[model samples]
Target: MAKIVNREEMAQGTIILNEIIASRISRKAKPGQFVILQADETGERIPLTMADTNPEKGTITIIYMVIGKSTARFKDLKVGDEYFALIGPLGKPTHVENVGKVVCVGGGTGIAVLHPITRALKAAGNEVTTILGSRSYDLLIMEEQMKAASDNFHICTDDGSQGHHGFVTDVLKDVLEKEEIDLVVAIGPIPMMKFCSLITKEKNVKTLVSLNPIMVDGTGMCGCCRVTVGNDTKFACVDGPEFDAHKVDFDELGKRLASYLDDEKQSLEAYEKANKQ
Candidate 1:
């Protein structure tokens, strides 16, 4: 059983958990890897990227937004609560090398996943710049952690509630115009990442994006998390949750993500009705 060491609300519907797991997984985890978790015996398994890991402490941190029935149940868990299954340290690690002047952009909950990658880039002798954004200041998560991971950081919100009064892409464009950046890494909602990739395309900067598709099995056998990259189908579970942003088909991915919306709504409604009774 994996015990939840701590749980805190980072935003209105987002929660971050520090959980204890087996030593083996912790030791193998690298930046950009993810894990499959089940809250209880009857719960469905869900894939979440590893936000941070402490090998010495044998603990892993995951930050998630509560958007579905399974995630809602996860949010109900408190400190000291035990998880039924925490199968982890999965997927390919980000290909980290000292690619000069790297810019890491994260939106909403993606900041958590971007944190470790930024740290890895810095350690690899690369100068790192980070941009974090959300709809409003109150919805932003992991600003401090991301700031600490990079040499330079910028924050953006849709409203002028904090930092720059525009999207992360706006800040990214400004920075790219001024600085000679070698590589760009972005993770967030599909639309946000898509736009970021578009902006970077104009500058011809190499951009990588982390994808979150509808995944069933964390392994390749399920075929549920397949995404097209450069006209080839790749499984997100095993092949990547990260791929070249310029080659990705965002329209197809967005359609695939919406395929389960109705089923998810029904499941949530049923779960709520049963609980109320």
Candidate 2:
């Protein structure tokens, strides 16, 4: 059992947990790795990337948004509670190197996943510029941490309640035009990542994107997170959660993501009804 040593609400419907797991996995966890966790015996396994890690303390931190039944169950667990399963340091780590100027873009909960990578990029001697966005100010998470990791940080919101009153891509385009960017990494909704890739493609900047397609086992054994990158098939669990953004088939990805929507709604409704009784 993995014990949750600490927990905090970072934003509305989002929670961060500090968990003590086996030292082996924690020691091996890199900036872009993820883990599959289950809240209880009856709970379904879910994949969440490591937001941060403390090897000396044997603890890893995960930040997740409550989007569905399994995630909602996770939110109810308090500090000191134990999780049924916590398996990993899974997936390929972000290919980190001194790539000169790097632009890291994240939206909504994707900011949490991008935080560690941004810090790693900066430490690798890259000039990191970050653009973070949300529906509004209250939905934003990890703004300060992202700022500290980046050479410059820009914020955008749909409702004009934050730094820049526009989409994150708007700021990204402006930055790309004004700067000499060598690499761009974006993590967010499918459409947002698609647009960021589109912008970077014109500039010939190498871009990477993290995919959060529906996952189950979080291993190649399960074909659930399969995505098309270039012309070949790749599993987000084993091959990568990050891939060359320009090569990804965003249209197919968007279609596959909708496959479980009806089932997810039914599961959430059943969970709510059971809880109410």
Candidate 3:
């Protein structure tokens, strides 16, 4: 059983850190791999990226948000509680190289996803500049972690609470105007990633974005995680959770992602009502 060893409320706005004892998975997991875990025998399977790992301790840390019923179910589990099933180290790892100056941008939950990747890039001797953002100061996570992962760290908030008072792109644009950035990796809300792609494409800077489409089975057999990159279709669970930002068809991806909004809203509302005494 993959038991929860440590749990921390990373953010009040849905994010959490769940450290689970999965010896094999922890040992084999790479920077960009993810796992599909079920809350219980009857729980739905949900995929979460590995935020950190402790091979010696036989543990893997996953940061997630209580977005729908599957995640909200974690609220009932204690540290010692075990997940019903835990599968993978899925997806290809991030392509990290010492490509001169690297800029890693993350927003909201994406910060957690970007954490290990940034660390890897820094380890490869790239002069990493990390940009983390959130709508407000309170929602910003992994500030210290990001700082440790890059040579230079920046913060952006839609509201001027902790750092620059604007979107992350605002800071990114400023950086691009003066800096000789060699590579860029962006992970965040769809619109944010989309805009980041647009900017980098215009500047002719190579940019990559991590995709998180709806996934059922972690295998590519399901095809639910299909995404269009350039002219080819790729599966996010197997081929990537990352792709070239300039090549991805963001317009199609955005429309498909929004399809679940109504269902997600209803599920959250129903869950809230039931939990209310």
Candidate 4:
């Protein structure tokens, strides 16, 4: 069992961040890797990308939106509580390089996954520009931390409650036109990533996207986190949770992700009802 060392709520309590004591995983985790965690013996395994790792503290942080039953259970976990199971440092780490100029785009809770990668890119001596977005100002997270990690930072909110009035793609379009960009990294909802990839592809910028399809065992053996890249099937767990954005089949991934939504909703409802009882 992994002990929860710290917990914080963000995005108006819609998102939860937990720092779990996992010394080995914390020591080896990288920017793009994820962990599979179970709330209890009966809880379903859910994969969450690492938001940060404190090797000195022997803890790995994970930030996730409480979207379904598994995450709802995760949200109920308090500091000093122990997870039933936590396995990680999974997936291939992001290939951080000294690419000249990088624009990192994140949406919603994806900002958590993008955090460490942006910091790593900046540390590698690349000029990093980060664009983050959500529905409104209150929903935006890690703004100050993101700003510190990036050489340039911008915000976008759908309701015009924050920086740019439109999507991150709108700001990205402007940046692509005005600046010479060497690389682009986007992590968000599949649709957001898809649109960002479209823009970056048109600009001929090398782009990488992090994929989080439904995962079971979190290892290659499960074959559940499969994604098609460059017309070839690859497991997101072992091969990558990160892939060339231009080559990914986002449509298929979207469909696959939606496949279990009805079931998930039913499960959440039942769990809530049982809790009330």
* Model 3 accuracy (lDDT, Cα): 0.90
Best by TM-score: 4
Please list the residue runs of candidate 4 whose C-alpha ends up more than 4 Å from where it truly belongs after superposition. none
Per-residue error (Å), model 4, residue 225: 0.8
TM-score of each: 0.96, 0.96, 0.97, 0.98
Task: Please write out the lDDT profile of model 3 over residues 208-228, one tens digit for every residue.
Answer: 999889898989999999999
Q: Cα lDDT of all candidates, in order?
A: 0.88, 0.89, 0.90, 0.94
How many pairs of residues collide in model 2?
0
lDDT of 1 at 148: 82
* RMSD, one per candidate, in order: 1.4, 1.3, 1.1, 0.8
Task: Give candidate 2's TM-score.
Answer: 0.96
What lDDT does model 4 reach? Answer: 0.94
Residue 250 in candidate 4, Cα distance off native in Å: 0.5
lDDT of 4 by residue, 104-146 (tens): 9999889999999999999999999999999999999999989
Better of 2 and 3 by TM-score: 3
C-alpha lDDT of candidate 2 relative to the true structure: 0.89
At residue 236, what lDDT does model 3 achieve?
Answer: 96
Question: Any idea what lDDT model 1 has?
Answer: 0.88
